[model samples]
Target: MIKDKPIFSVKNVCIDFKVGGKNILSKRSVLRALNDITFDLYKGETLAIVGESGCGKSTICRTAMRFHSPTQGEMTFEGKNIHKLKKDELKNYRQKAQMVFQDPFSSLNPLHSIYYHLERPMKLYHNFSKTERIEKMNEYLELVGLVPAKEQGEKYPHELSGGQRQRAYLARVLSVGADIVFADEPTSMLDVSIRLGILNMMNDLKHKLGKSFIYITHDIATARYVSDRIIVLYAGHMVEWGDVNKVIINPRHPYTKLLIAAAADPEREGKVELPIVRNQESEVTVWTPDSKGCPFRLRCPVAKSECAEEFVNAKQVSENQFIRCIHD
Candidate 1:
């Protein structure tokens, strides 16, 4: 279904972290984690945030879920400011927006049985009776392809495989009646053979149950497979964002092009890490954050004097597609 209304709207959101000891704390010790990020998340669509490890991908997810308050700007969920919500309201909002953490093993409670894990949410959120909770838990557990529900229910997390644990994590999200799932590298730790299974399950969850997913990952190939739209982030800034196919086939930003090329290399017989290209001095990686120019000017191959100016408009390359670079 095409959602005319965006489930979540992030407007010029910026986050900062204070470094150094309490005694050493100073105004100069602030580190900008996110710099004026703005985006819209449509209902039931899988939007992938792809970036390198330190590029603020997870920070965006955490901030969107209201795990931390933003230093600047705001995030609206269902037309309400998430940051301003009080205890009761925030708890209610937390139920709607649940997180599937990166490590499946770490996320699941090792001591609790699978049934205990799923049933607790149903009991807490929906207040289902013992009988009803058990029944509903089985339904969701089986929905994620966890067979022999009776036997699996009694088993602890350590008893299950990695894929099984991941499925259990998905089942947990369903148990809470989560409308939006912020899956931060959900399958990054799984075996290569089983990663697709988890991704396929996420796809099925979106299509069948109509759940919106914010998939955060560095693997662009997996992002392309699972996301309807892909956002490319670099050094805490969004360089490119749009349809997955459009961005992959025709990358507009140099950073995006490099990311795509590194993730998927048709020229190579087998997958290999793309060589890192430097900008001028090899000793230091430079960023022109204060310059009135494109954010990617340092690493851009086609850099020019004109590119040293701010990009006010994102060009419409095609329907449902836009790019921020004037050089594009």
Candidate 2:
């Protein structure tokens, strides 16, 4: 069961990337990828970050994994500052936190067998004898539903189907003894029939192994299926966040409503017309660093004059829900 205390916390985080110089002699311009993002991941629970492409969903995973450092704010893992960890502390931190990439095919080494992939992490993190390692490897493979574990071990990455490859990745995560896993679109590439199985495995890992998870995806339906909490990101800003069911059932942010609407059944009759909130020019530059008001005002149907005058902070709308709109 998940406790009330947070296992991981990201506070007032901001990330900017230097794209290119405007001209030969001009200084390089910066693009803000994330702005003032804050959230927490509790033990044995999954926190899903949901948004459309380029909305900073993956950036949250990257920042949390320390693949990229933020320009502002701090991240803490079990009360320790993540960015300020010493060399040994950093190494130990890496062992505790692992990532499951979006593409299973690209994540694994095509040249190596499944056994080799699982063995390497165990070799780095534990002092298991060859016999013990072999036993544990087979155990984890079986745990992930890869039956006939010994036979699966000898097969190379290319020999497995997409679902099998993803299962191997999950087994590898277990081998490393990761307390937290950042799953970046882990099922996007798999067949629809197999996606739920991968998700169910993740749920099992959370409950059975006491592992915390951050599941990033563009699909709200999947996010709702697997997460305890859901955060809606738009143009690097958090628009709506709360318990997954609360936010999904009573979406307060305009952008979030549009997202839910967009994900609704397309073939159903009496389809609600998605509001066109942005002009052509506004659509071109989705990320605006100089905007004084809400980052989503440009696309919010109910935005007012005050929304254009200053940025709004998140306010508690219910016992477990928060919205970043002044009107809410």
Candidate 3:
């Protein structure tokens, strides 16, 4: 059974990037990719990070994987601070945490065969002998539904279909014996017919293999299908989060409501439109440190003067759900 305790924790993490100034003579400025972002990833559960493009969904996944360091706050794995680990310790940490990139085509080496790709991780992390490696490779290949493992092993990346390549990537992730998998838009590039199959594979990995996953996607429908908990992000800030069902059925934040309403529904064709707040239509704004009050106040229909002047505090609305809104 999955534990209720957190396996990974991101506490008040802020990520900043130094960008070039408008003019050559002007000073450089900082872009806040993430602002005070905090969440816990529990064992054997899929935590879905859903938002529009550039809302820092990928940024959070990268930060969790130790690809990017946070300017402020801390990230811990199994009670150890990931950012403070030594070289050897960091290597060990990586063995437990792995990432599946969006594009399967680019992720795999065109020159190498599938067996070579799968065998390398086993060799690196487990230090298995050549015979042992081949044996394990076949086993993992079959485990991911790539049957007749020996035949599939000899094929290069280009020989495989998009869905097969993705499956191979998942097999590689398992070969490393990863406990946590960070999947960034894993199904965005695939055919619509195959997307569900990939999602089913992920579900099997989580439930049958007992692996934890961080699924980042813009598709709210898919997010709801795959996640136990959901976090809604806006302008690098967590607008709403909690049990997926609770948050989706009863979204409290104006931004969260907007996202849910924006989900694609075939039956509602031509009838659906972008949300307009208080007769005032607004577009998504870029993140800035100088902005005050709520980051979403500009587009909030129920926003008040206080929302534009002070930072909003998170309040527990349900058993495991929290919202950062004053009105709701």
Number of backbone collisions per candidate, in order? Answer: 0, 0, 0
Q: Return the TM-score for each candidate structure.
A: 0.91, 0.95, 0.94
Instruction: List candidate 3 stretches off by more than 4 Å.
Output: 22-27, 267-270, 277-281
**Model 2 alpha-carbon drift over 4 Å, by segment:** 22-27, 266-269, 284-289
Model 1 accuracy (lDDT, Cα):
0.82
Better of 1 and 2 by TM-score: 2
Residue pairs with clashing backbones, model 3: none
lDDT of each: 0.82, 0.89, 0.88
Kindly list the per-residue Cα lDDT of model 1 for residues 1-328, writing each as its tens digit.
3579899888888788766556645333566677778888888899999988777899998897777798888999888899998888888888899999888888988889998889888877897778888888888888898988788878899999999999998998999999899999988889999999999999999999989999999899888899999888876777788898998888877778777777755666866655455646532322333435565666666667776667546676766666777765
In terms of TM-score, which candidate is strongest?
A: 2
Would you give me the overall lDDT of model 3? 0.88
lDDT of 2 at 99: 92
lDDT of 3 by residue, 49-83 (tens): 99889899999888888789999999999888998
Off by over 4 Å in 1: 21-28, 266-276, 279-292, 306-312
